[model samples]
Target: MTHSASPFVPDPSRYIKRSSREVPVGPVTIGGGSPVVLQSMLTSDTLNTEACVREALDLVEAGCELVRITAPTVKDAANLRAIREELRRRSCPVPLVADIHFKPEAAMEAAQWVDKVRINPGNYADRKKFVVRSYTDAEYASAVEQLEDSFLPLVELCLRRGIALRIGTNHGSLSDRILNRYGDTPLGMVESALEYARICRKAGFHRIVFSMKASNPRIMISAYRRLVATLQELGPDWNYPVHLGVTEAGDGEDGRVKSAVGIGALLADGIGDTIRVSLTEDSVREIPVAKALRSLVEQFATAPRPRDRIVPPFDPFSFQRRESHRWDRNPTVGGGEPVRVAVLEENLAALEAASAGTEIVPELGYQPRLVEEVDPEDSAALTALGGGPPRLVTIRDGCPYPPLYAFRMLAARIPAHHPILLKDTFFPGEEGDPLRSLLNSALQLGALLCDGIGDAILLRGEADPRKALELSYNILQATGNRSFKADFVACPSCGRTLFHLQETTARIRKATGHLKGVKIAVMGCIVNGPGEMADADFGYVGGAPGKVNLYVGKKAVRFNIPQEQAVDSLISLIAGEGKWVEPPSS
Candidate 1:
């Protein structure tokens, strides 16, 4: 595999955040050495002035630095004026962002009322009909001209109004032009945003931020890294603030795990200027999670690291599993096998107690005496170990570098296929807040896993062995490394949602939680529903108020079923597709 000499993060030795241009959204500033800002979107309809105002206040009170409201049409965009007026009358001055998709007029109108306006590059000036066609040089240049015509007005307007613009791109919503050229990859996501960014820069408008969002954590992580690298390649002044998130991350533990893995990884890498944890619950509920993750990054930033800089061993832009030979036959540890989940237990009795009666047992129980542990800084020792027969190797506790860097250093020194076991912490007995540990583990381990570094993971900081075992599997699932249960891609509710998303998501999960390895998507609207859920096995989407649409892999077979009967119909659809199985009795 080809490797980049420059590290993905700016400074591997310390938490030196990427140097970026500060963009002001109202009074709050992002990037330019600013502490990462926290933000969330309102679920209340834009037309409901009172509800929108109340939700905005609630989010601000819950520590949301910026609030976003959806404006799907010109009328909805106009309503943002009322929401803004109401918020100001109540003395809540949190800067508001208007989310616009497929509507340039709405973006223009929203810009008049809000502090910032967000436009999805995939749909801002382009249509998404999933059409497949080739664009010649002439056709492509014409498309770019059309995009400039549609987007330049907004750039000019935002410049005059002193409003910031977020050129956000989603994985599933790439325009046919981008898809045909870039093929729905992370590179496509970054290129989509940069196309609009080029227009803003040409207009001499610098109040801009960017987000590369996806439901899958691995894709989200890679897209952000690629965006940063691409921006670096463009020029020194091209460093714009970045907003990080994993969109359509479902509710509860699953949602938190996914968000932490994606957002936390980037934060640890010192790439994000602002962050939002997109949970499919009340918008206010998202703040605490974001706060926890931010706190973890802050603490890591303050902590000391070795003076020497070490380069990353693998490519950060793409997911290429490191070549490794088969190290074990039973519950395989390497050789193109699924990443194994393991636990750090002293003996068999403790392992039994922790994983007893659990189907998701650790494949390997690591005891210090049985496995070889090498000093992370000692490359000579690691090379000597690599010269011998392949055996399980890991960083010994108390490495000078941080856990994340220590592992990267080890990966660099060892053979490509050494089957290294990853741990959340390299230091023993360093424990405090459970939430901190959870987020830290996700950030460090998730960062490595997404980089295709880890073959096995151990949650060493978690004291509760059962919880540790469960979290290890959750991290694996969130990183898209493995799936022990059904997978979900549910979007956080916004003003465009037609029905209660939290309740519907719970109902669907209850019915299908038993289907192992099944990938399902629960979306609130078609704004991003059909495209975002393209990789899902089945889709449960809101068609309208109390209405639902079901799809079997990008094709909607059932439309406008009443919300109450939608779950049953979905089950039947799954069975019809030969994917449904009866749940095992408790």
Candidate 2:
């Protein structure tokens, strides 16, 4: 891949953050060379004014730059006015964003209250029953005209009211029209957002930021890269800011891993201006996660290198591990093996107990003093082992490449064959904060693995070594690096769920947890079933009430199986495919 140069940045910086028009949302400013902003959503029901106000205040207190509340209806959009007023009264004047999914009227109404309005171009004016039809060129143009007519009034009103718009596109929610023509691909996601962006531009409205969100990090990264490249091709005058996120990213370590993989990969390329970490936990808790991820981005704000070194070893626009001479250093790591796990905890005994065969780099002098390069003698001494020559599993570095720019500079100087253990120190926010430890480790390490950069992941934390090891593998598995056990790609149940998602997911996971390397998806509804499961090996999606549809890859193998029998049927399907081995009886 070659780096394309442009005039907007003059010299070395053009290769960094893609230039975007400075979009203002009340007191906060993003894009146009502004610092990367952090955002989160309010989970309280929009009708519950007290809860909504309370949640907004809590998020702002936690360093949330922009707060979005779901406005699924006109009334919910109306409640935002009181929520905004109350938050301001409480001295929390963070910019409010209205998340409008389907209703154009709600978006118009929300613009009257919130500083910014985020509309999903996928579901704004189109439907998603998963049907396909051919569209003639004339018919498509007419559809565009109708869509523009529907959106122009809001654009006009937003311009008059000084409100910003985010034309966000979701992978699972693409309209049938876009899907029919482009299929469910990254190009489709980009086109879906650009369709609205084109109309907004025609109406002389420029206060727009765009996002392409998917549960899968690879697709999310590719789409954002393609979107930026497409905009550059369109012209520098079409500069628009980008908001980065990965939607429906589950919960706990898995969610954090998925979100980090998608969002971090883009930020490393200097592509994102504002970021939101979508977790299944409390919205206020999301702020810390966003800050942790953004730290890496800020650390590498400038272009890492003059154009040539801009792209990493592998192509940034696609997924391909860099070419390297294999090193069979550790049994599970290096030599083209699946990415390995390592730990640097204080308790040597606990570390040994947790990872029987895993490598443990000493904590002393691990944090780099120079931040760039270390003396060669010191590096060699650190990696020197008593056992016949140091293996590739262990690496000695001056400092951690928390930012991609640092990584690029160091990778250029280091040996390609030597396996490197990327490190991130996990920080649990406060005492008694559940999920904090897991989320911190996942986002920090999973970010690099998603880009196919690391040979092994190292999480330095104070938890039990076994827990840290488990968290390391979970991060790797979530980022498609390694799988130690069955991977459950379940969605956080929404209102349309047919069965008890939490209990059913637990049951399915327990029953099949022994099947190593198998990816099983348990989705709550047809709305988020197949598309959301993207690369899952098998799927158990909600069909009719109490019935589940089973899938192999994207094809449904069984239909309408009773909820009580679904888990067994899934097991049989796996056995029939030679993927199931009976769990040893305790």
Candidate 3:
């Protein structure tokens, strides 16, 4: 049955509906069967009204339906009124969302000025110091009661001001109390937001959306899935809209691919209502990526629910690489190996033409043909004419349809077990920016890779062959499917960062750029360092003024080392662990 976008109506449908309550952020409706909306954030300083307005307008013009600005203090939040007024004067009326992390007063003040306010549950009332403490049941109850007492005013203010609220939880920013109980896991992330959500619900504050963001796609996807599953247990009334994002995803191809993997995986499960492709780049650059993802969801998401499809046996809540017992023809195609990249060769002439200019690596294969329309006799024809089995089955794009949707629909009709190549074709927009094409390619193909689908990626269009090859590898590495070079996890710094994160990250990258297959994280402070770098092999974190804390995984192996000597110490730690290799000649 269909659901209405009204607070009084209950959404009972699964999959597309996600059984979530409807919330209105300005004129845009989220959850309760509403179409997924697109959003992005302004990176400029909030106090800089001129810069913030320009960036926000750019984001809006680029198709961002909702724009968020950070308000770290009372005054910073007050300036939100100026930003909103200026946008109105300039003829852009996009809804504004104020991002609040540590200040409750700012949340209260921000609510009066913007259309929406987003509060981080981890730091709204408490700062984390990794302290360990034990609490009696009475004491725990008392602490929660105090928090509710404090949070009730803000909830009441939102109700009076007609503003929406988002209880956003970041994977790396969970407080010590949460860690003490849940151990920095996805369950902990969900509980952090639920604590605030339960408070809002108790106070009749239902104009809410929730987000579980993380830098690691695997962790982010798992946390959101766990959030939905937990909410499902609480019954139909608890399903609020979820805002999907991969926070602090780094620049260019890396950023786009990482965001796609997390956001797309969730959207594929029909779990998200609004999406923000959180790239550490220009705010306007994020809009196209967000729209592309929205388009993908609209194109492929079926009404009867993809649940009916004969999907491969795999768990969505946990990270499990897709597996197969045997390949029918291509014996080396499946059975749990790192995915291989292949080039699509349609006809013999096209293959000959491409081979003349393309670098033919010894390992790369050129598939002969791709079947689009399935005929009743096609299986019989294949069996009768087959000799040694098709090396790889390819799904190509000859029409305007999305390659991914085509891939899925065609693959479902074929065998239950066979490695398929997802051949995504791309053409630059009217602007002729090759970067846009690259972003779209990653948005479409990266989604499949993140879900453990697609055996190979074949890029087609007018871009340079060398660039295509590099981008293919980058997409694979970004999605955690494969890696061939140094992977760096650097935080997007805020007011809390103690050092120059950009320059220091560059310095660390220069010294360790040669260590292939090694993952390094450079964090500005302890706030997001330890938890955000959950997957990094080693971490370089700012501990205090001019001092650094180096970590092997999440454990601080060396504490309080001088800033000048920190890089050397990190190297030593890596070398000590036998994971570092000497750099070749400069």
Alpha-carbon RMSD, each predicted model: 1.9, 6.3, 6.2
lDDT of 1: 0.86
RMSD of 1: 1.9
Task: Give one digit per residue, the lDDT tens place, for model 1 in 357-459.
Answer: 5556777777777567998767578768856666778888876656776777777777776787898887756768877777777778888888788888888
Identify the runs in model 2 with alpha carbons over 4 angstroms from their true place.
1-18, 89-91, 300-311, 328-335, 342-395, 399-445, 457-464, 488-586
lDDT of 3 by residue, 1-586 (tens): 1112222112211224466778888878878788888888776778889988998888777888998888878999999999999999998889999988778998888888998998877888866776888767787677778778878898999999888999999987887778778878898999989888999988888998999998878788878878887887788788788999988676656777787778876776677999988664556877888887776666545433222333323344555554433343432555566666554333324444554633232124454433222321245633432344433555433434455444544444455355566665523223445554665577567756665666666765325555566677777877787777778777655444567666787778788866877888888677667867767899999999799999988888899999999988888998999988877653
C-alpha local distance difference test of each model: 0.86, 0.71, 0.71
**lDDT against true structure, model 3:** 0.71
lDDT of 2 by residue, 365-428 (tens): 2223312223222345433432342234332343333333343333333555555556654222
**Superposed model 3: Cα runs more than 4 Å off:** 1-21, 31-35, 85-92, 131-143, 301-308, 326-331, 344-362, 369-420, 425-440, 454-463, 493-510, 524-527, 540-579
Ranking by lDDT: 1, 3, 2
Model 3 TM-score on a 0 to 1 scale: 0.78
Better of 1 and 2 by TM-score: 1
TM-score of each: 0.96, 0.76, 0.78
